[model samples]
Target: MNHLKVLALSAGALTLVPGLALAHGSMRPSHGGVVQMSGEIMVELVTKPKALEIYVTEEDEPIPAADFDGTLIVTAPGGAKTRSALKAVSGNKFVSSGRPGSGSKVVVSLIEKKSSAKTFASFTMK
Candidate 1:
């Protein structure tokens, strides 16, 4: 009887692996972080590093930025816009170097070379 219960519990735990993998960082009201995913665009608005990270995901949830050669158009404070390119960071993540000021809005526009789809994320610092 004990062995049967153990097996059932193990099976249940295994079933949650895929579900957990599919779910990325969640933006809860308690943590003051918001993770927005719409279609293939995922945006994580964070004020810590004074930066905003925009992630482009494929239909299979794989980050497309790894092999994506794109341009990032960033709009800074006082309505100043600058264009920068993206580089791969190790695994499936891309990083952009910028320091945003407090209470300033960041606008990121991503344009992939191989595709015509454009993803955008705008975050305001607090």
Candidate 2:
């Protein structure tokens, strides 16, 4: 019947919504780090020997590091948590001192200065 056809069409359209939502950009990490997609924004976390790096991008383009205020929360394997402020280092990079140990979990939260929008990315160190 026509009613059944309409319902089927509506269901099909709903399935495509998610795909369209993710069409804004690729989720791959461009900075040799782990990447997470927060809505249309992409956040990448790079762990170094003595520092942590955070990168933010939207629509596959880097968002200026100066536009955000960020914080890094690292939970060690033994359950100790350390919090550090992320400072803008360059174009789209934010850095914080102290490297997270293996088996540690890192969470970076960034707040946009102009809109106050928050983007979060989580990573588990190997």
Candidate 3:
């Protein structure tokens, strides 16, 4: 009976292994960055030279960064506030020319529109 009990436990654990390995696709941010869920919208942030490149995800899957709209918010080294606009620079990326000194955080707000539905995501400068 003890051997049978051990066998059952092992089988149960094996059945649950696949559930632990599921990977959620798409990109997300690290520290000082967050994803907010709004009415049919998502807010995301991504890093730029001195700007924040924001991309809105209209679908559940990750969309190329080149097609995203960029909004950059910079908190200057001296605690001043500045802003810049981001434009698509290349494949899967957006960029800005605003020079936010070191230690400035770039907040990107992107919006995505899909067949009558919209979503969004945000990324921070890294």
TM-score of predicted structure 3: 0.47
Q: Which digits, one per residue and each the tens of the lDDT, describe model 2 over residues 1-126?
A: 999999999999998776644378888889799888887778888878888888899988999999999999999999999988999999999998788899999898888999998888888988
Ten-residue region with minimum lDDT total, candidate 2: 16-25
Q: Which sections of candidate 1 miss by over 4 Å?
A: 1-33, 45-52, 58-60, 70-72
Residue-by-residue lDDT tens digits, candidate 1, 1-126? 999999999999998777645544443322245555655556544444744444544443546565566455655567776767655664445566665666566555565556766667666655
lDDT of each: 0.57, 0.88, 0.52
| Candidate 3 segments exceeding 4 Å error | 1-10, 16-19, 22-62, 115-126
Clashing residue pairs for model 1: none
- Assess candidate 2 and give its TM-score to the true structure: 0.79
RMSD of 3: 7.0
- TM-score of each model, in listed order: 0.54, 0.79, 0.47
- Top of the candidates by lDDT: 2
